[model samples]
Target: MVGCARVVNQTPTLPIKGESYVVLPFENYTETPYAGYRVASILEGVLASKGYNLIPRVWSINERELAVEEIEKLKESAVKNGARYIVHGSVNEFRYKTGLDGEPAVSITIFVYDAKENKVVKNVTVSGSGWVHESLGTLTQKLLNRAF
Candidate 1:
């Protein structure tokens, strides 16, 4: 498989009601520069569009190598900023497929955590390929919706 994502815990639903969220910077695993920022921006836009208040801040820690202390600090900051939840993510893949079609492709993993409880709520991995003519942002949004 090109990509996959799952929550570490048993939470099956996200807090989709009247809750606020903070989106941390996503770690970009691919060679494409700014891919991580791109994913983070998209997530922020989508969440805001869904009627969630977004905490206007970017947690600039390395998501892949975050330590317990760093995570605690982040959670505390989010709580202080009045965010009910925070989202961390990684851009696992961000490039066009190398073939005749050269389709735009993206793979990402997102983790949602409860700011007050300092525990994960849900995580999801989603990958998608778009037609040669489609924009990366549109394809990413479609894939994200599927994951949501």
Candidate 2:
């Protein structure tokens, strides 16, 4: 929320125009890591199609390659790879529940930060009851629009 800002409610769509960017894998907070990675891959492809530069996350740490014992070592490696804008995204919580109220509930939160600015470029959560699944793609695209 500084120099320039805009929000486009179209998820899973490419941008009309702009600068390049790198989209990091979103941290999966669900019961399965696979679910998290699946979403990340989708996000990556969408952004890539927009002509933004992207950095593959696993190419550096190799998933669990760095433990608490190797923080320092990994730092150097990440830098050597010529990373400028590091995308630290996460899906901290996802809940789908149906109770006595007979209404289903689902929520997904996505965050994108600008490494250089050291500020949260975008922070928002999308939620709905039944049929919320249809909005996931739309929500992600909305996040990316603000991110770039």
Name the best candidate (by TM-score). Answer: 1
Over 32-140, each residue of candidate 1 has an lDDT whose tens digit, in order, gives 7778778888888887777777887747635354444665577678778888898877888888878887778888889998866778888888877778776778888
Candidate 2 Cα outliers beyond 4 Å, as residue runs: 1-20, 59-79, 92-107, 128-148
- The lDDT for every candidate, in the order shown, is 0.75, 0.45
Clash number by candidate, in order: 0, 1
Q: Tell me the TM-score of each prediction against the true structure.
A: 0.78, 0.49
Candidate 1 global lDDT: 0.75
lDDT of 2 by residue, 110-137 (tens): 5544445555555445444434343444
lDDT of 2 at 127: 43
Which candidate comes out best when scored by lDDT? 1
